[model samples]
Target: MTGEPEGPDFDVPVGLFEDIEDLKAKLARLTAQVEALTGGDGAEPGEASADEGEAAGGEAAADDAEEEEWQYPPFILLLDPPEYDDELRALIEWVEGVLVPGYLAEPSADARWCHLWWEHPVAIARLHAVWLAWQELTDPASCGYTGPSVWHRDHMDPALRELRGSTGPFAGCVKGEHQIDHRMPGLVPSAWTHAED
Candidate 1:
């Protein structure tokens, strides 16, 4: 006759609530910063900005809703320094605070890594992709009960293998050393170079 649900109790991960709150605070601050930089009037995010008049308020609201909806930019690698700086800092914070300590194994010959991972463009792109997936897949409202597991199995694992694997972008660097001049192999020379020979 007891009607208390029968499923095993799900223990929320330690510090998860704190992490969500922190992310919310950071997002708010970043939103404000962006607004200031873009000459916005400091309106709350997603709040449509328009004159509140008896006759025109509704139409203005609808139009402003579409116009002012904030969207996170993708492809940090494609952004300029000013555009990507904040995003890069956020990614760095997450990597250092969570990803490295929680998920990464010790660096070794087989699991190569670089201290200056940001110096490697490909590594930055890959890590950014992983971070994006992490944000979406870890959100309970966005993804169902299997969110975290899906993030780990699909996003984190593949990214870690690609980024830290022996032949990855960090292949030329090591745990304590960063190759100052490391670069991806250049494109093959013009096919016509040999035509003259």
Candidate 2:
């Protein structure tokens, strides 16, 4: 009967099943490696990756949301002239009674007051006027015999001498030249009396 081995029966594809099994085993190994790397400490592998991504995103958002830095302005405190002794005293009283208390109670109020004092010319002028009024009140004899001179030359002369010794071009000028022009020479006027027009 035709016994030539029929050419080795070539119907099935060569190595097809072995290739499929090999690929399945490789996939399983890869999955196991991923699980080992990510799945520890009771958390799923995917959850850790998600959490890390969220954290990175939050940091980026925070960086983007940063604000500009702030800066402070410069300032100075001005003192009244000695001639305005009455006004200075009044100012000290006002500061002690109203300003210091307000500032202590609310820092923002002090800041606002400073801003107003710097920005408003009228406020500065008002302060100057107060000082002028005080100076006039403290030494009523400044305008000569036109009004009663309550200020004593004995006391004022020494003050003038002391002022002359002070350092500056205008120091001695107050008593040496200016005093002669502004001294009170008659009876002392009442506190309420206004100078003759």
Candidate 3:
């Protein structure tokens, strides 16, 4: 009579699960902080709203919990993650009404961003930051025309450094200082896009 515990017995660090839960809570707090800083509240980003969160019953809740570990930040900006839907609608209108038609092609391909890039999580999140800053910064009375300059220096520059760095979205695709080429619709960083790896 072998007394081995079960089929998949594995050594785990004591209190590891507790530690992980603690980390998740901390991360959720940070996410909430970012949301608050950017004007949001309640749970973290990418989490479900009240209906989806509560209506999950049982199986759906587990499924959501499973996926929650992997989801990038949702493309939402507001006081609540539940507002993601509304913000997405607004973002769609803005992108379609402004960013796309006038921005599809640029003077330099390196500066080109695919409208489809909106589908990428990183792009969505980064652009959300830019858009939010633009909203407050571009108020004519706030900073005058220098608003855009401030936003570019504060937000856009940092985002671009990551989004277009040597190892960023256009990594391996950027030809030189002035000519990044994208063969595909999305320009996600290889690290984030290559989940299979």
The C-alpha lDDT values of all candidates are 0.72, 0.37, 0.57
Off by over 4 Å in 1: 1-68, 183-197
- lDDT, ranked from best to worst: 1, 3, 2
Error of 3 at 10 (Å): 84
lDDT digits (tens) for residues 73-162 of candidate 3: 443643365577677667777767865575444423355343355555566677677677877788965468889789878986787666
Q: How many backbone clashes does candidate 1 have?
A: 0
| After superposition, candidate 3 runs with Cα above 4 Å error | 1-82, 101-112, 157-161, 164-166, 170-197
Better of 2 and 3 by TM-score: 3
Steric collisions counted per model: 0, 0, 2
> Please, what are the lDDT tens digits per residue for candidate 2 over residues 78-129?
4445534554556556545644464323222112223123222333344444
> Residue 73 in candidate 2 has what lDDT?
14
lDDT of 1 at 4: 78
- Indicate the residue-level lDDT of 16 in model 2: 82
User: Which 10-residue window of candidate 3 scores lowest in summed lDDT?
Assistant: 174-183
lDDT of 1 at 154: 90
Between candidates 1 and 2, name the one with more favorable TM-score. Answer: 1
Query: What TM-score would candidate 3 get against the native?
Result: 0.39
Tell me the deviation in Å of residue 13 in model 3: 73
